[model samples]
Target: MNHLRVSGLRKRYGEQEVVAGIDLELRPGECFGLLGPNGAGKTTTLRLCLGLIDPDGGEIEVLGLPVPARAREARRRTGVVPQADNLDPDFTVEENLLVYGRYFGLRQAEARARIPALLEFAGLSARAASRIQTLSGGMKRRLTLARALINDPDLIFLDEPTTGLDPQARHLIWERLRQLLNQGKTVFLTTHFMDEAERLAHRLAIMDRGRIIAHGAPRELIAKHIEPQVVEVYGDGAGRWAREFGQAHSERCEQTGETIFCYTHDADSLVHHLDQRSGLRYLHRPANLEDVFLKLTGRELRD
Candidate 1:
């Protein structure tokens, strides 16, 4: 059975439909990423899967159990690391895990037995007695992840798990998440960071205005939707250059504020064209997921 399944999923707030006729199926032990801008219905979709909210139309099966009907059964096998850290401020690091374990009906002895291993796994063994306020942002994030695992769930949902952390902290969390996949855990992730999605996700879906515009492996989507080369031009007269030669020289062009991006399979011709223009700084690089994202979603701001 698929780990999670959604077919014709639909939701609405008043007259505005938030999720429109969505479909998804996640296999076991793969990292699936949901990517989009603000107000793109990504969070609403997550809520639907988690049985936090009911969809007005469609069917959902999480771990083969129909959602909101068998939601408690599904939630027992699933874990969640929310966007915000909701760790109890008054509880010690170890105490937080113990308290969470209780929700799964773990006995005091069983919860205590899991605490040492969980703390060690999260690199918080030394801070077992420390208050939540004493831990750094990264440490707290790791702790939240550990807390979610108190019952050893098979599927984990991570919502922007590395949002505000430093690079080092982010990399640490990434490493730990990768380890979970190695242990054969299915990870469902949602994030705005393209690089993060490209680095960790085996498959990704980009949502816009309640619909999926693109879905596939990151490199595959890039190769299928966009040209191989991109030239970014900025500084003075960039707009003039785009207006003058964008249509003739490149397969596609996009302008945002003072910067204009030209996409092409033939970089040499575009480079030759731009060689004559002065006072405009340019960068030439291979197309990436961000290019695919922008091409599918356009350059307009969401909110």
Candidate 2:
């Protein structure tokens, strides 16, 4: 059975319809990503699935159980790493895991037994007695991830799991997530980083203005929505060059600031011209998920 299924899901706030007629399904052991901008209702959808709030319309089934009614029951088998760390300040690293494990109704002995492994999994074995305040940003994030696994859930929800993390920290988290997938765990992820979505999501959905506009395997979506090749020229003369070259050669073109992005089926002419221009900084590469995202969602900044 699918880990999660939502059909015709809808949610509203005052006059605004945040989630509109959404449909989604997650196969077991799949890392499904949900992408969207602020006010896109991504969080609301997560809440609806979790039964943290009731939907205005539609059906949601999590772990084969009907939601809102069995949301609590479904939650027991699902883990969550929220966008913000909620670890208690007073608790030690070990204490935090123990306390969270207790919420799952684990016996003292069982929780204790899991603590050592959980600490080690989080790379905090040496810091077991460390207070939450003493940990760095990355360490805290890892601890939160570890705490979510206190119950050894079958499904995990990670909301912007690497938001404030540095490159090193982000890579570590990615490695850990990979390990969980190897163990056959289903990961439901929400993130704004295109690279992260491309790397981790087996399948993904993109949302805007409270609805899913596009979704598929990263490469599939990229191939379907954008040109295969892209030439990004950025410098003082970029906008002018884009205006001229885009009219004659590119399938599509966009100019932001002093940078010009030319999307085309073939970039040979563009690259040849760029190479002739001295001191012109340009990148020629294959299209990626971000290209598809921008094409479908537009380049306007969301508030």
Candidate 3:
């Protein structure tokens, strides 16, 4: 059975529609990702699913229960790690977990009994007595994740869970999330980091301007919308290269920043064409999620 279902979802702020219309489904044990630039309505969609705000139109079901009407019951089976770490500075590492568990109706004794295991799982067993303010950014993130799991939820929502962190810290969080998946927990996440979504999501939907532009497995989307290989030409005369190559292969060329990218399955033909031109140094590589994002959504800044 699908763990979550959303159909024709719509939300608006006054007369301005932020989420025009959207639909998605997530099966058990699947890691589904929502990718988009800022103001693309990713957060608004999450809020609608969580029943934090009522959607102007459409439906949302979590674990077979309709949201808001059954939000309380649905919440009991759900966990969330918001974009920001909202840990209480006054509480100790263990204290935070205990406090959050209370919201799920866990008794003090029951919450206490779960503390040691939860701390160990979050990698905070060694810092159980430390105040929240004393933890490092990575530690705080882990604690937030642990707090979400205190209720032993079946499904979890992670919103930009590792936005600002070192590579090591990010990898640690990824490993932990993978462990959760191994235990059959479903995860729904939103991220701007292409690598994060590429590495973790089983399938994803890319949103733009409050609508889904593309949806599928990362590899599938790349294959369907972009060439397997891309040749990136840089340095001086990049624009000339883009113009010349774009005219020769109008369907396969894109210019961004100081580079001209040529996307094609026949890399050798493009390479032969470039060899005749001077000041046209390039790199040939496989296309990734970023390439697909750029192809579907033009290189325009969105706030």
Whole-model Cα lDDT of every candidate shown, in order: 0.92, 0.91, 0.90
Candidate 3: list runs displaced more than 4 Å.
245-250, 272-280
- In candidate 1, which residue pairs get closer than 3 Å at backbone N, Cα or C atoms, i.e. clash? none
| 137-213: candidate 3 lDDT, tens digit per residue | 99999999999999988999999999998899999999999999999999999999999999999999999989999
Q: Candidates ranked by lDDT, best first?
A: 1, 2, 3
Q: Per-residue CA lDDT of candidate 1, range 1-303, in tens? A: 889999999999999899998898789999999999888898899999999999999999999999979999999999999999999998999999999999998999999999998898799999999999999999999999999999999999999899999999999999999999999999999999898999999999999899999999999999999999999999878888888986578998888889989999888877877787778889999999999998888888889
Off by over 4 Å in 2: none
Off by over 4 Å in 1: none
Residues 94-200, model 2: lDDT tens digits? 99999898888999899999888888889999999999999999999999999999999998999999999999999999999999999999999999889999999
At residue 284, candidate 2 shows an lDDT of 97
lDDT of 2 at 218: 91
Clashing pairs in model 3? none
Error of 2 at 180 (Å): 0.3
Q: Give, for candidate 3, the lowest lDDT window spanning 10 residues.
A: 242-251
